[model samples]
Target chain A: MSTSFLHSFQSEWLKTRRSLAAWLVIIGGFFLPFIMLVGRTVYHEKTSAESTSPLFWENLAGQCWQFMALFLLPMGVILATSLITQIEFRNNAWKQVHTTPQHFYTLFWSKLMVIMVMVVQFFILFNIGIYLAGAVPALLLGTVDYPSQPFPFMYMLKTSGRFMLDILPVVGLQYLISLQFKNFFVPLGVGIAMLMLSLVMVEWKYGYIVPYTYSPYNFFELRGSAMSGSKDVNIHWLALSYFAFFTVLSFVLYISKKEKG
Target chain B: MHTIEAIGLTHHFSKEIPVLENIEMRVREGSIYGFLGPNGAGKTTTLRLMLGLLRKQGGEISIFGKPFEKHRTELLSNIGSLIESPTVYGHLTATENLTVWQKAYRCPKNRIPEALRLVGLHGTGIKKAHQFSLGMKQRLGIAAALLHQPSLLVLDEPTNGLDPGGIIEIREMLRNLNREEGVTILISSHLLPEIEKLATDVGIIHRGKMLFQGSLASLLLRQHQASRIAIETSDNAAALQLLAGNGLDPRIEAGCINLAAAEKPAIADINRKLVQHGLDVYRIATVEDDLETIFMNLTNQ
Candidate 1:
């Protein structure tokens, strides 16, 4: 990147401090793991019995993904993306940024990069939370011995990386919609409505077309459920394609807009 | 040389509704030019077009002798603007807000404190901009515009909602910037008296057309030419005849004998002649036209 573009990116990153998106990342990351930790401590006998299984770590990860992929990750992306994009609109600062020395591409890509980086930061926090959720129970309950199975660092990272890819289309679509409208509820409402539609169409033959369904469908497939639509199709590639399409379309529309503010 | 020049600028929201028409404006270097217009006279739109905030649908804008569209980024490095209301990030403190622009402008970090001090906001410390009073927020906006130390400053209605004291403060600051820093300023307002106080050059725009553009002295000269004298005497018909007979070209208008292009000395001479003609001059008032009256006359035309 050019120095000016890098500077624009740095400015965009600093703008997110104390923002709602920042809070969403922190709170969303710890939410599920904290719940899991609480549930295991309250029901130690069940957790202790479950820990004896050889797939203990894998089972715990699956449980986390059950909530995350179906709801938490998608909702987190929707809210965080909208909040970040709304910063300029909320403060009435879009015209201000446009008049700056930075180019149109710099403003567009820098803000998008900050949102994407925040998503990555969210994933890192979630992974650390997952580790704590699994380990805290083993430490707190004498009846629950540490799981005999080794920590699945590689498996956890691989699964987290896949989940990140699965949700990119959500981030892209939400960012695009958010940038177009000043009303926060508009994008949030669209995301919620699409997510519901995606859930209803998950079993349909062409459910892969709705990018929102990728997370839930990927989770169900990983849990050994029968893949809907074509059995040989890879939804990750579909997810990536949808992400690229929305990203490019939004960029074109944004820079060409006559009255950006 | 001119710091900014716009030629044949025209814009319309729709084919049937034109906002600006064939407008030409020249803002010279090291001069404070006040852009004057009533509400909806296309002042803000013209300023937006000059700064490239809105796409120019017609005509050319050049700043520092280069085409605005082809050399926008380079020209913008030396142009700072505050359009309409102040744009302040509610979540960030005053310092943080300037820091954001400091990074974008790639200016020295030290300029941030200097800018804050320039705007009397250095003492604000950690107060977020949303909490600032309207005047303070406007100040902070000006400070942000000055952060890059641009040679040209474009401000739209900078004194729109400021209290008298606040207006005075901003006026003095603009004067100092023009005098000390040699920064050219193009500030717009509907208030002629306000512009009369600060503007070295003035442009009066009305209904999407440039009515008058020149130095304040030339506009005052136009005001001088437009001045009139009004006389009410005991015998109004006889007084009109007597003044006209004396080659004063006086006529009755709105129940008074009026003379066009009358000067201060003409007021005394006309009064003395009326008394000598056995007509009691009840009142003789020299209506010296002000800038506001001149603005009204031009806009009315």
Candidate 2:
């Protein structure tokens, strides 16, 4: 990290400590996987008719991904960005920050960097949570050949890892919207509206190209087949393209934008 | 050296009327310079321009004997500002909020307690700022601004949201900082009397133009020496017409009528003329003008 970026990150990180918004990322990470565990247990209890179910983990994992992709991930990004930036907006601290020695570039990008670090931390904990959510419970129930099958560990890991790549660009978009508005509800409303729009248009042939719907397609369409532990950049190149375009535009606008009353 | 010098500052938002035009202000080092103006008289705009929060379009600003824009980064490290509303992190404790700025300003940790104590909030332990009253918040804002011990403190209406006692506390604190620490303060206020007791130098701005900028002692000399005759009348229009018909220029203000010339002969004579015109002359008194009257005379004109 450059000194300017480091200085900004230090301030950003200090503000995040014990902040409610920053904790939401951890809660969201833990809560989503914990819900999946409950769903799996209920599914396992209802399946006495079949001798054994092959689709037990698959269906549960699929549902978890669908929820994460469509609603939870997008909403998490929205809330996190707004609440994080809202700390500055809440008491009108932007003037002090503006008058500081820190340049707009360092301040803007450093915030993005903090959000990126937070998202990565969330993704890692989420991956570990989901893995334990399935593997630990399955072992206790003697439901399936756990040690013999060794628990599709790589599949769970890859899917969670894929969630990061696909979801990060989503975070970038929310950061742009969140930083522009001092009112938290404006960006939050826009985020929810876009998420709803993404869900409505997910079935269109070219819908995956839409940035909001990209995660749903990537998670749902690719969760089943693309879990082959293969690298495919084309899966989210469009989301990445949008992320890069907006990130640049956001930086330009932020650096050049003169503050006003 | 002038701590802050804004020469020919011209600013406009879009093609609208210029908010500040050709404003040249000078603040001497170690002097509490009051940027005095009525509401919407561009007091806030001029302070923002001085702090480089607003872009300088047509003028040069010098701070600490150097061009402001050129040495902004280095100069900002030596300056602290609270513009309009106080900037505070409400979620954190008072100590924690100061800690956040200590890192930003790279000041030592001991200064946090010193600042809080200076603001009369030293013992409020672990209380988050969200629960603080408005006066406490304003004090905390001042504490945060004072955290780095800047050479020049630029505050825009710092006493706002503070009560009478809180206002005095801040006024005393600013004076102490100026006297003991030699910290130069540039404060903006719409109320002349409020700044009258604090500022060493005063700049009266009205309608984006500076009406007067000089030492407070000099301004006060003009204020105290100003003598005006005020007449309370039953019918102000009749009294004004009577005074005008008698070659006296009497101006009506609020309910009382005032004449620029104040003398015992003038006071006795206006009373007689009003009665001759069948106007009821209530009480007429010759009183010394106050700072508010001086400011009104300077800015209202």
Candidate 3:
């Protein structure tokens, strides 16, 4: 079983080695931080504030990743899930892959694993983007007002680490969506729509039911509820619970469901 | 031993319209079993069910002498299939597409070349699958299916996009695969003439039901039984009246007079009698019933 799982994993990895979507994930990681750098530079050039604070780096790290939880990360998960599985659907390869000696469960889990690894790749590249965008401008201007001080490695790790834990359910949800729909754009459109709805839903008392909002609610609250000022979300328990629940549910349905040629 | 057997197989895409029902099919070992049908005859659906591509609601499929469900993965390792359309990775090159399946089936690396060569697509360099023509794409799909050297090959409309030469090439290859490699093949084709040339055993289906399942000889025998003699002249109506008056039992169909006869001698005698009566016989020939006619008789056509 392990050998079979490995084979499926290798097959998927090889398939996506030069994939455009995988490159998009890498490009997206750099997207937010670089934009932030451009924004801060414009802000400084337009209005050079007299007060210089060391906490500028701290605030930049906090705001960028918080924005990630709110928007970019969720979209990234959706794109990765959709793009990775699009190959199977586009080629109508589900039947071919399923009819092989490897079980669907193994292939299903391997897909989930590939998506997670890609998310991690984004996280690592995102951190690099933040560090360079923060330091490059600061080192040139020699200003303590902008993000110019020592890189906040620990702070960024703790913040993004919370995101990784909190977004597990979104991964599971998107995996199921990609496999269930034959149309390539359905999962992507649904994910984006769900994220938009989750933004509105987060204000309601039952917003915790929406997996898309978990990452934002968790990371902002990672400074603990006393400091961040949100009280209605169950961060770890719901995500982990959703992950475990959907993994089994999707597996059973996926195996029993007829694969389209 | 049979390579594949479907016992009372049935399927439906929707509750209102049944796709296939009570389909009993068997593919014997080491023979090319042609699943003959017209367009939308549920040929692809039945093949999908046998491969476990579709869920079987009310049936049992046994392959390699055991229940397909009980040992699906083990049984699948020996089966190779290309159903409905060609499946090729547009992002990858020709070689890379074969490599992907080669990894999945865990076949030897060298089999890739042999399969590629068999399909007449070797030595094409740096051409991604998206660049391939329709015929090239079909060839690549076949190469991938053969990459693993499967014991049974399930191909649905394998010659849909191929040129005449490519079609004949595939025919000869399938024949060689059956005769030399002893591979059991269950191929589906809507064209009766194409299947007639390649298949040893045939199963005719229409509107999702089995019409006939037997040998090629049996099909030919039915064709022989359907033979008739067509009498043509400048004035078909005159020839028709003449044949009818002479007790030849002629029926006018498609601008000619047709008489039911099992042999050429009867047709000649009719022609000679027509000439003797001063009725012009422009042409007189035995119309041996073709496989297409036999297929049309079996199905709605």
* lDDT at position B40, candidate 1: 95
Candidates, DockQ: 0.80, 0.43, 0.54
lDDT of 2 by residue, B1-301 (tens): 8988889999897778988889999999999999999899999988888877787788889999999888877898899888988777877888888887887776789999999999988987978888898888889889988998999999999999999988988999899999999999999998787898899999999998988999999987787567777888889987787788777788988788888755677677777778877788777877678888888888878
Q: What is candidate 3's lDDT per residue for B161-271, written digit by digit as tens?
A: 999999999999999999999999999998888988999999999999999999999989888878887778877787788778877788888888888864657667777
Clashing pairs in 3: none
lDDT of each: 0.89, 0.79, 0.81
- Highest TM-score: which candidate? 1
**Residue B34's lDDT in candidate 3:** 90
Which candidate model has the greater DockQ, 1 or 3?
1
Residue-by-residue lDDT tens digits, candidate 2, A105-204: 7778878888888877777777766666665555656553332233466777777676766776667777787778888888889888888888877776
Q: What is the TM-score of each candidate against the true structure?
A: 0.96, 0.84, 0.87
> How high is the lDDT of residue B301 in model 3?
44
- Evaluation by TM-score, superior candidate among 1 and 2: 1
Clashing pairs in 2: none
CAPRI-style docking class of model 2 based on DockQ: acceptable
